[model samples]
Target chain A: MAWVTPVTNRNATARMTYLDMNRISGNISYLYNYAKDHGYDVQGDDVSQTTWTQNDIISYDFWYSMTGVLGEVREAAGLDKSVNYPATNYYSVNSLERYTLYTWMEITEPPEYGLLQNREGIQLQTESGADIEAGIL
Target chain B: MPTISEANKMQIRQPMDIMVTLQVGGDVSLTYSGYSDAKVADGRLDEPNKKMMPLTDLQGDGYPLNGSCKLYRPGYHPTSEEKWGERSNIGEPCSITITASESIGYVSAWVSGCESVTFSGNDYPVVNGTANIYVEDTTATFTFNPLYEDRRIEVSLLASGAYFIFNNDQIISCVVSLRSDLSLINPTLPESEIELQIYQDEDISERLASIPDETLITYSAGYSDEMSPIRNFYLSEKITWADNVMTIHAVDAVHKLDIQLPTASLLTDGSSDTGEATEESLLVFIRACLLYAGISIGIMPDYEDGASNSSLVFNRISLREAIAKATAWGRFGDYPTTWINYVDAGIPKLESDYSSAGWHIYEEDCGDVKRDAARKIKEIRMPVSALSFGDGGNYLTTNVGTGTWIYGSGAFLDFDDDVFAWSVITEQNAGIASVKSDETDYAGACERNALNFLAIKGLMEEGLPMGSMNTFYTQVMPWNSLQLATWNRYIGSSVREDQNLIIIGSKVLKDTHIQSFSTGEDDGEIITLDEAPIEGKLIVQHLNESAQTLYPNIAAQSILNMSNVTGSFKWKGDPRMQPRDSAYLHRVNGVTELITIENITITHEGGGTSAEITYRKGKC
Candidate 1:
């Protein structure tokens, strides 16, 4: 009889993902100032810095945030979840959650492309007629 | 009857006397000093006609509003970046703004309430409606910042932005957006709408911005070194006394005007080395030399290839026949007797060439001498090889040593003991190898020949201005130094400053050197040129007017050395960067004073007898 005992590697237990708030905040701040100086304002909006439940669980991970006003919470934290499944012979819970933890977090918005470069349909289609189908999506 | 010389002098003096009389008021009389006595004609004053002085660009208080227009296509930019637009001093209390609204394209602006505005060329455009104004004014009042829906405004300015226009003339207008006030209500729906905004400055535009427009009112001498004005180069000092040699040098104030002439075909190289020259080129050169002197000469015939041969025999034609003859003969070349024609027919013959070159000289319908004085008369010089400088091994050669140098001599070749028999190819390209190869010895030979020729002529001497240094030494340095005949033939002189200096265009290295010589009492004094301070380098010197000097900033030497004009060099070395050497030409601010190149060309060996060098046997 082979003595079989399972043990998880303690060294790989969990690593803290460092969030670069300085750069992100700085870029956001620049964009915000640029817009403000140019006489355009979305003053009520917030540049949030949210902490997701998968903060220490996922590799190369930092929570990404979208901006929204306080009343429009759905637009800000729209269905963020981590679906973690079993890797091998081990029952582990990849914690998934969307906790509006930093809903009031302040963020500096990075600059965006100017009025001329931002339109969508302005880009050209690669090929109107492909060999596969007419409206191939 | 007055002799021809006296008649010409009287003709010149006649107009002068009348003009003086009119200047002194209606009482104008000619005081004729007769052959043996001073005879005063009393009460016979020719009444002043008060002839109108011809109108020119310089006649008005302000250059008459040649024209004016607002500038279009304005944009915003960073504070440090340079913007393209006319820079003018704020003459009075005027507001100039580049306004950009959602409805209109950018337009240039000039808003002066009570002042004269002058615009340069059609390049300055002014459109109404839309503009993205980047104001450079501390005093501008944004009273009512025009605002509309879907519109954005961006403004930037350098510190203390003040326009410098002559008092009273307000300059306005820059980069106006295209028309946006058409049909669209909001005007923001259009996809390809042109909007003006600040962007990063590219390096090339930055360089283009720094070079100030150096306004050098130069008159071209025949076959001018076209490379001069286009490159911010100028010929400031030149001394000329001889006919055969002109030591040409030019300086690019920013870089050395060290242009090396290709040993190959310079004509096709976009370098204007026309094989044949006429009075057109002669006049150009003469005008260049005499431009500052104010002496003028009329056009002469292009005698090379015997263009004057036809017009020489046209004396028999009557005045009516002369006009008819002029219509029939487009160029003096078509006439066989041009050389023998009287001086009175000189104007007609020139008119003929002008017409053949697609210019209407005499309006047949109006029968008027369309004296468009705007097309001023100028002189030019043609290189000897361009005309007729013999063939092959029997070609002219200069033996520059302390010994007797025999040139233009048939005895040197030993063919038939009287004349040398060799087919000489005067065209520069004939001597160059067409295909590139290790055996392309011709190019090497040309370079060596150029160095020797420049050395012999004392052209590469020190203390010359920075402008001429690069043009001659670098731009057109030849490949063969032994081809003395080709080098000599290609080198020709014209008057850049009438009677005072000779403008020699060296094709081997498209350099224009004004030969400096002095006449009368101030001839021998060593005039130091340490007066006009340029960059930090001081071109200290002492030399006679007959000598030449080449002065280059130590920073510009690398560029010159790269061009291979290793003439005399002196460097003061840079203190900030130790152990690192710098070329002279790059020293933009270090140039100190009106420095000159000093060199004396002693053509005589021992007997001290001056020899007359001619282009062809009888042409000069």
Candidate 2:
């Protein structure tokens, strides 16, 4: 203020706001389309901006994609994709999508259960209903 | 190490080529090449089912039908990358439709349909105003309705295919089952029969493109060596298939005779007297009997000069049994008896020679022939524990023509004793009441019995062991130095080594009654008792006749004592080692002991060959 120069900050601020809004809208549309295609029920009010912030929408998309990618990677590696997710965290994807991705990966490349075995570790269920573990040796 | 040719001689010859032919009926004959395995057994006794040929597939004209309707079950290919995730049920229900053809009978075509089917043919009548259709899962049944009255058609289901019998004799694709309980008593037959098991589609239908039981089966085996030449092993009997297994029953030639001739048919006519016949005459009679029964004669020894006067009356006994009885009589009648049916030669013949002419076993280390390392003998077993004297500690006596013959010192002869002591007595009016008038017959009978008793006693007095030696040799024949060792070790080690060593095949000569004279006056007939009558007195009128009879008895005893070398030598088998053939054995102790091959058994297992030879030490 003491040595103020005539500079227009409003344009920069408007540009940033427009970019933020566009990013939020794009993330919402992507999530909406994904849910509709995959037969998932869409919840919350899409018309109001107060219910979901631009940051919140971006965060949701980030987490959803992270978990979806994790399921796909596990399936491709011939492993079970049904990982224990955090209960408190909110995700945009439904359980059906997660399970479908897991099944697809399982059928594509079956896992070698012997490699994951352990003598004293977490107990896992086998197809024959027997309890087993990884890294046995 | 032996040379290649020497080693080959010692080793068993391999059967290179095998051919199999199957004859279903008279007209429907099917020959198939390549068999899973084949075995032909040639024996010295009667054997049923001689050849076994198992064909993996059935291939012929118009077999397994053309238009198939779910005839085969779906197959899986786990390694196929393209069809990994796909499922296929292509040949399920195992359905096929066969139409009647010139080779294929009408009954066979209808019976081939395992599932429900509709039948429309010239010989069969249609039902329900159209072709007879047997609905799936329905109680409605359509009988095989043939149009012709005289041509009755019969259909039977077999393990791999269907069987049709028409016009009583004509068979269409027929495969019969073998009797489960078959009798095997003939020793000349093969020890085991041929058994073949084939699965439905994997083994039979797919490979040859035919039904399971619709093919004929036959087999032949041959060797390059002249000893065992090419020969066919065939049987005219029907093939047996059960539970997807086809078995061919092949019996020996003797067994074939047993099946063709009934027990009653072997009875002699009893017209010709065996007693009055010369040695040649008796041989002719025996030859005639064998020829009538379709058997061949191989070797026949000369008859005993003394026993030729003894007459034999055959009633209802079999010819084989009669021949056996005739060969055991006379002075030189202790010959070994054998019957050989050469499967390869297709000849069955009798062998009775016990001479040492062509029998000899050379030692491997002697370097006379090639010595094979594989045939290195490891063990030799000579067991003498079973040797025993016949009728020890018993007095033997017989009377003829007013003279009584007695032997024995009223005590058992000690093993160390050299001389046998005996006493003679004269008895009056102790004549054989039944044959009192026939003094020659009475004298002959008494002389024969007395000789048998003395021979047995003299042979057993020294306690010379009667044992068997089972040796292992690399070669098929027993011509080895180890055989010589067996002979010298046993013979030279004993004090009574002067005893003549007699070699007979597996056949052992026992004491036989040539002629019997009855003393009980029972219509002047001969007495047939299991045991000799010991509680009777014999009567005769002249001592000269008695002396003549006793002379023959003494001669006979000497002959029997010379033939006391009994036992068998078992080793690797060779077809050339026939019974009664003589072989020389070079002993380990620098002695060449002549031996005879008594019995031979050749066995082939897992490409390893061996022979078991039963031989007697010494020449006959």
Top TM-score model? 2
Writing each residue's lDDT as its tens digit, candidate 2 over B254-311 gives 3333322122111122223232232343455556656666565555544433322222
Runs of candidate 2 with Cα error greater than 4 angstroms are A1-137, B1-251, B256-277, B296-312, B331-346, B350-359, B363-572
Q: Each candidate's lDDT (Cα)?
A: 0.20, 0.28
The alpha-carbon lDDT assigned to residue B121 of candidate 2 equals 28
Q: How accurate is candidate 1 locally (lDDT)?
A: 0.20
After superposition, which runs of candidate 1 have C-alpha atoms over 4 Å from their true positions? A1-137, B1-163, B167-620
User: How displaced is residue B529 in candidate 1, in Å?
Assistant: 34
- Cα deviation in Å at residue B580, candidate 2? 3.3
Residue range B1-620, candidate 1, lDDT tens digits: 33222322331211100000000011112221111110111111111112111111111121111222111122322122222211122121212322222222212222211122122111221111112222322222221121222111111111111111110011110111111111111111111101111111222232223323321211110011111011112222331212222221222221111221121110001112121222222223223322222222345444434221110111111222222212221122222222211111001122212211111111121111111111111211111110111221323232111111122221111111111111112223233111011112342332223432232223223323221221112112232434345334443223121111111111121233322222223322322122211111112122212221111121121111111111222221111110001112212334421111111011111211111111100110
Question: What DockQ does each candidate score versus the true complex, computed on alpha carbons?
Answer: 0.00, 0.00
